[model samples]
Target chain A: MNKQTYFKKFKNIKYPISRRGLLISFMFYSFFHFSRKLYANGEIGGPFRDRFQSFRQTFRVEPNPEEAKRIINNIIKGRDKRNNLILLNAPDIAENGNVVPINFSVNCSMNGNDYPKVVHILVLDNPFPEIAKFFFSNQSGSADLAIRIRMRQSSEVVAIAEMADGTVGEDRFFVDVTIGACS
Target chain B: MARKNYRRRLKAPLTAKKGEVITIKTMAEHTMEPGVRRDPKTGLIYPRFIIDSVIVRYNGKQIFRSRWYSGVSENPYMSFKIKVEESGLLEIEWIDDYKQSTFKRSVINVLDNNGNEIFPIRLSEPSQSENLQ
Candidate 1:
């Protein structure tokens, strides 16, 4: 139909309009312009700000492996025992980077003296690479863990475990991206 | 105040035999709200909403745990393997940064070496647990 005819027919429709409809239409149109401005200004800053703040207050360093190691090492400085380590990597080809399944098992002796005290996983290249930090006691028998993570791109994944006697261990994995995993 | 919504689902078998290493798949409905998006009406930034941690337990004992970040998607899905040994219930609990928590439970049936259902146990109700703090 021609544009003029379409407009005429639309206006002549025998449906009664309520004030709510007019108010909604006006709000919708106003929102369209408002959203355009927001997009142009790029004012988006989600939960990442809180994450950044937390990292800054806790570690005072970037969320990279080297930085993480330094921070963790400082926490265990002056200790005498070694820590067991396991490196976990995403699959060679991830279908989605946003929610990639990553698993790591630390072969630690479950004995009272050698049990793992904590497990920390870090992604070196993500916007916020610190994926998870798990603290365990002797009761948590095994040091094996699995989790899903969001990846911005191909990056290195690292896992670090601390033992009861101050021993520290480490693991690393490389992830290749076939698809973006984060929105 | 904005209303928050979250949900989770399991994709693995609900029953397994003792010592059987089976994969458990789970996904949750979440906004994973980064708090970065601007309100089209007010032009103000939204608050952040994301899952921070999850724990899985069998018969009152923790078997799996994890901590997540904002990089995760709006609705997050996770898969992991657990070796069952006793006839006990399976439970999963998820918590967000806002101090909100949700729990899900499923019955686990322990089987014999011949794959016979020998023992069936129901997991605890996560919502009713006082350990959520």
Candidate 2:
């Protein structure tokens, strides 16, 4: 049947007001309300919740082992193997936190077949831990990169590299900051 | 609006041979504000301050460009390598999000394999040596 005719047929139909109908209608309304409540609560646990949690954890000035593991697992999920990745962390005593130099090198063949696809660097302790993402092609020649990053406090830096073979490699470095970046 | 007290220094060798990769390092002084902090006295959030882009030109030809972010620390420092093909003017310009800008220029002279000057150029302003000549 056409959609218009289907709707028109039901538009005027009225069922008798019986106990069974009332109970079924009540159950349907209750289910709808319950689902709405569940959805509203789930909104608090959305993807951005991890970002908010990271911000809060930085301010609390406390070490969170669970949060650290979550970050590691996320990195592992995005890594690709067949590329040699090296992650270098800044020295523990950073004279200046504002412009800490971080260097990364990948021992990849750099050939069209085994080139590195992407390099992602993250500072797990920073307000925004996703520091930088670099896309490299064969034109890059070498997979060595150097960049400066800001850190609020001493934290661990993680580097993940994805290779052409669909394998993942990772390295981590711990940095100590004598001077905070915020200052 | 407050007067910013920052400076940048870019250094590279004045001469290189053709097809030689030269390392250039630049250090700039500026506060890279992340805009996430509130002033204790005024309770006002500071606007983000960062060097947004840098471009290097060789004789009016674009050679290198970089995009920066707040993740880069204050008083930013960057180092990169570029190949010198011939004698030309090397110009570097830095621009910040606040619309403040600065430019630094250097003359690059390419030498031959035998260390003989193939292209001679001077970048500094007329000095005592030039005055004597």
Q: Residue by residue across A59-104, what tens digits does model 2's lDDT show?
A: 2233354565565565566454434455564666787787788887
- Candidate 2 has a TM-score of 0.59
Q: What is the TM-score of chain B in candidate 1?
A: 0.78
- State fnat for each of the candidate structures: 0.29, 0.18
Instruction: In model 1, state the lDDT of residue A49.
Output: 32
Give the C-alpha miss distance for residue B97 in model 2, angstroms.
2.1
TM-scores across all candidates? 0.60, 0.59
Runs off by more than 4 Å, candidate 1: A1-72, A75-84, A92-97, A108-115, A135-145, A153-155, A176-183, B1-4, B12-14, B37-43, B113-133
lDDT score, candidate 2: 0.67
